[model samples]
Target chain A: MNDLIQTGKYLLIISAIAGLLLAFTEMVTAPRIAENNRLVLEKARREVLPGAERFDTLDLATTDDAGHPATRSLSLGFDAQGKFLGTVQTVSPKGYGGPIDIVLGLKPDGAVSGVKIQSMRETPGLGTKLAEGFLDKFLEVARAGHPVKFFVKKDGGDIDAITAATISSRAFCKGIRDGIKVVQEGQTLIQQRAAAPGATPLPGPATTPVAPSPAPAPAPAPVVPPAPSVPPAPPADPESPPPAPTVAPEPPAPPLPPAIPQGGGQ
Target chain B: MNTKELTKGIWAENPIFVIMLGCCPALAVSTSLANAFGMGIAATFVLLGSNLIISLIRASVPDKIRIPVYIVVIATFVTMIDKFMAAFTPALSASLGIFIPLIVVNCIILGRAEAFANKNTPQDSILDAIGMGLGFTIALAMIAVFREVLGDGKFFGIPVPLIKDDPCLLMIMAPGGFFVFGLLMAWKKHLAAGGAK
Candidate 1:
């Protein structure tokens, strides 16, 4: 019993010292660690929303397709003259390995401006192809103002899923679709804030009415003129105008109906 | 202080080969040269720090609770390196992943603390750490180079033409690690035997 008490005292002293040392180290490194994280997020934002002169964090509430609240915020991109360019949203959808965090930039009219994968634990060579080849297709469809489809050719959608990484590919598509839904649901409020400069858009309380019908059709027109103007100026542009139109209507093709059921069952 | 304590870990008491300590990380992170080197350096930092501290406090630590005290000391250093890596070298930190934290449980560290540090002077303990750490790093690098060149057909991500185009993919997988580790161990044993003769 005497020896036990002595051992207990020694253990307590060592643990207390260890705890104090760790606390000191944490205090010293916390700020720098936070700064590193912010820099990574900032770089991802810039990559996703290229050509934006500046970015502003907009406090906007987002909801899922089921109208349940989802945690997402919009980063508003503006040109040199403060013209509203587009918005960047972060979405994490369930991927094969784990949650794949994607940073998506969308034009005010619901087109994809760009996509940058922020973080993912997908298989090194296979699922990781989503960052390399697979993302380009989504960017192409979004640039053309087409509804995004989230499946591969085997499932009857336009996307050629990553070889042997169909699940990861589908997860990528799901994240993109979820992001687009957020932009669509919050479109009216975003446009209102964009049009009325200096107006603080309050986070609406529960049951914020889905804007009345016919809003989606007219919303694309004003945003469309600016979209074409920026892409054509450089002759070096890879995604030229002609191919976009041909691919734009493909998302609305019969493949979508069959793809939905297959994705659901899987 | 005796120079034998420092020189022994380099060859005779080599951590990975002869001593055969800390093999879990040796196999797991040895897939890439860069990853292997990073794990090596992080482990070295923890080993050196823990050994020095344990040596300094060896007299005061009671035999009845020495293991717990040593663990607390080692864990403190591991946490420090883990945070420092995350802040300064985020990419390396991400690639090394769980192995960085696992350094706390690495047997080479605790073994040294028990075998060498507890009985040695601080200066001797520091040298032992440096020698053992370098041996571990070199061993891991050797294994990494073989695996990477054969498995991925790349030496540090630079593709070799014939091998890169058609390489044995198994070298980067779990079975590949075991194969290389066994071969390397046998080769080291052969070299030691020849040297002795």
Candidate 2:
């Protein structure tokens, strides 16, 4: 009976101390952890869309232009003049391995500002390539120079495919294309309301219309190298890219196409 | 109850190689030297705190609910370490993911409290705690060195010769972890046998 009583007493005391320590730990570090996450997210937002001094977030209803339910995002970025610079929103797409989380940025026009790959447990060398190639496509795609609707070659858009890692290329391609479609629809809605003969319109970026001609033909073969190697686009060459570098930084690794190589852009 | 008790944990009762507790973090985070170091420090904090408190109450604690009591004590330290890691080393914390919380049941600390510290003096318990922690750290570091070099073809993120340039993709995969662990275990056993012979 004495032994039992002693044991019970010890248990109670240990339990009380444990509870106190745990509460103290939670109190001390909870705020710091929260701050760290916020800081990192902000950094990622900036990297995804640079040149914008400050930014805000928007709750884009996941409803597609068709008014169907889907994954919506809280958009982040800054407004530079009438144009929304660094406009970024995260989108998750299921890849061959797992869900790939991507941040898509849009410049003033409906073109891509850049892409930030936030999370992926992709196969290291192969699937990981998707996160690296944002620049060539971002600059060229964001320019909206080509009147043709943007599509990754797999979807028949002119965008070239990464050589071996086709699936990652397609996943990234789909994400950027879908993001463009969403932003354009939003812009159109804003424009429609403003152009009404009597009404002063609400402010927003002008939406680009989805082209009647759909994304270009698919790539069954002839893995065209990405823009990094494509004879420097005549203007914004990364080798000596112009003042406001049109090319986003490539992934640290060497360019994709085994055959054609460029000056190592360390 | 003095230094010997503590020193024993560093070698004889080393958690990773000898007792085989907390193998998940030992292998998972041991991919990089930095990660291994982070894990080692985190585990050490938990071990030291838990052992100290558990020893303080060993005399009073009732046998009926001792397991539950120990769990609560262990959990408190785990939370402290987890929170500290998150705040101070957010990058490492993010990389470690769920492994930090799992330290609660790391048999090394709990096992020591139940076996050694409960029976020993406070000073001895603390030493044992420190020793065991160091031993675990060294084991993890050794394994990480092998894994990072062979797997990613890098050491502490710096590229190495031939390997990093045109890597052998296998070392980074899940199977590679098991391979490294088994080989290390065998090597340790061989060394021990050789020393004895």
Candidate 3:
């Protein structure tokens, strides 16, 4: 009993000292760590929305169409002269291996300006290809003012899925759709905050809305002209003939034709 | 203190090649030289700090609770390093990921504390910690060099001449890690035996 008491006493002392040391270290490093994280987020935001001199995160109190509050903050970007550039929002959807965080920038008129992947834990060679230019197609489609399609060609939608990584592709699309929703719902609030002088930020609501299913093509007619326009200019440049043909054919042909045979074989 | 306490960990009792300790991280982070070096330095920092503190409190620590006390000391050091790295070198911290936190359970810090720090004086404990830490670092670097060279055809992120275009990708994968580890262990054993003869 005496030995047990002695052991407990020594352990307690050691633990107490360790705890105190850790607390001291945390006090010193907490602010710096927070700063580092903020810098990383800022860098990602800038990449998605280039030319924005600064950003202001609007505290939107309004709920979505489903009546639940938004979970993400809608950041409004401004130029050097303080003109409104667009809105930047981040959305993380469950990917094949894990959640994929995507940062998307939307033009003031709701066109997609750019997209940057914040972080992902998908498979290295297969699912990770989403970061390597696979997402550029989505950016192009968004810039052309077409409704972002969430499914692959096999599912009666236009977006081409990554080879052998359908799940990751679907997750990436879902994250973009969710980001668009956040931008759409918070647009009025963002405008109001920007217009008013020193507006008090409103707190976000408690419950986050469940993201709704992909809505019917908002404007399908505009998509057809952009598709042909994308291929012609690059191919006309004789200096880059090899790369143009390879790029044009690979994006449209390889995924669709082979997908039918591959799906049937499986 | 004799130099044997210091020199022994480098070759004769290398924490990875000979003593076969901390192999999980040895394989996990050896995919890149930068990661290997970062992990090595972080482990060294923790080992140095833990050994020093444990030695200072060796006598006062009760025998029955020595392990827990040592753990508390080591974990505190690991957490400190983790936070410091995250603050100063966020990119490296992100790439190293979970391995940084796993340093708490490395076995090397605790092993040295129990085998040497507890019994030895503070001066000798510091020396032993340094020797073991270097041994661990060198072992990790060696594995990383071979893995990075053959797997990615790159040396410290620079592409090598002939091998750059068509490198053997398997060398960076899990099976390749086991193969290289086993080969390195065999080579080390061969050298030890030849030196003995």
Candidate 4:
């Protein structure tokens, strides 16, 4: 009937008007939403690299070992002075319940500057505790200035995994280690590509570190020093004696794990 | 236009407590009164807009695609609200998280469109939406006040007079949401039944 056609026309007009109103709203909010996301990412950038006046981005390709997840080129951020700040990689690890997204700040020397939880979906008050001060423990151990490259106390890492939330803790630790590995892999790939006939040799720190090994503190499991464990300073005039003899061991904990010079002298 | 429908929305047909329409926010943002207020206003705006649009086109919409049409209208509004909040109220937006975008799916807006707008005139639908949205906002605000006062020992981050002395940590948890909703529902039903006498 003609009435049915008129009804359809009205419906069409009404929906069109509604749709137009929504489109206008989307337009108004689009810029603001984008700014918000940028602000958040910037805040995380600041947390990971404190005193960073400005940040610069570098491209580094990353691929998983299984070859399933292939992200071409993670970003390496730097401060205003062009000093290497940290590589901003979305460290996605299988968290307690789901995926935990984190951004890791790696110093030029390979030690972590800081780690920020970008996003996560874990049980509150339980697994969520992993987001609390858990990453800070890794940072504290890293204040010694190195990456978290091993396991928990029970398994033998420098970090204290959250009590009762081992899964969340491990998830965070693994995210950093793996993210670092990806960057390393990318750097190698770039270096190799540069050596090729058509490529420009990339200028970067040689992956091979050349230095002496730093002394690791007494780990409960292995009381033996990983290198030269400095003997406790004598109680008398500790500062006056000066711990300069330990200097040969103090500078190599992070980058020299593989590149320590032959020192039968130790 | 009439008081029956209007009063029904305020209590008998309450969108949240009795009907439990927007439960996502009920459980999600009730941790703090500020967050709850933000969510309540967002939902109310969506409800008001959708109700008006649906009622304006009620006669013309084909039954087959009415739901889809309603969804589009709701989603558009939600996206707008989401962007605005992100830009202007960054802190509250972060606390609210994804619930803002998820407002498109809040059952209260769609429920009102289908149940009331489809049968009512524009003015009546508008009134119904306003009354029901206000009711939903009040319910969420009440739950949020209780949780924030007990759980954090404060109101809107200001230390409550005596709550800080003995705060209840339980009110801020997921279980607290269920407890508040259940208690409020029971109390509302009791009052309605007793008033009938």
Which candidate's TM-score is highest? 1
Give every candidate's TM-score on chain A.
0.63, 0.53, 0.60, 0.57
Clashes of each: 1, 10, 0, 4
What is the C-alpha interface RMSD of model 3? 4.3
Q: Order of all candidates by DockQ, from best down to worst?
A: 3, 2, 1, 4
Candidate 2, A1-266: lDDT as tens digits: 98777767776676777777777877887898779877876777777777654454333333443445554443434333323353577776666557677777765454566677766655433455465444365456545554434455676665666544567666766666666554443332222211221222323433222333332322222222222321222221123223112322322122111210111110
Q: List, residue by residue over B88-171, the lDDT tens digit for candidate 1.
A: 888876565446655866898999999999998999999999989988988889889988898868887788889988778688
Q: Across residues B92-149, which tens digit of lDDT does each residue of candidate 2 receive?
A: 6655534565466567778888887787777887887899889888888888888778
What TM-score would every model get versus the actual structure? 0.70, 0.64, 0.69, 0.63
Report clash pairs, candidate 1: A112-A142
Off by over 4 Å in 1: A60-70, A83-85, A90-266, B85-99, B195-197
Write one digit per residue (lDDT tens) for candidate 4, span B63-146.
866887777666766666666777788886655544555466678988998888988998888888888887887888888888
Candidate 2 chain A: 10-residue stretch with minimal lDDT: A257-266
Candidate 4: misplaced stretches above 4 Å? A1-36, A72-82, A92-101, A109-112, A115-208, A211-266, B1-12, B63-65, B83-97, B148-171, B195-197
Per-residue lDDT over A188-241 for candidate 3, one digit per residue giving the tens place of the 0 to 100 score: 344443333222232232111223334332222321121122222221213322
Every candidate's fraction of true contacts kept comes to 0.50, 0.58, 0.56, 0.35
The number of the candidate with the highest DockQ is 3
DockQ of every predicted complex? 0.37, 0.37, 0.39, 0.32
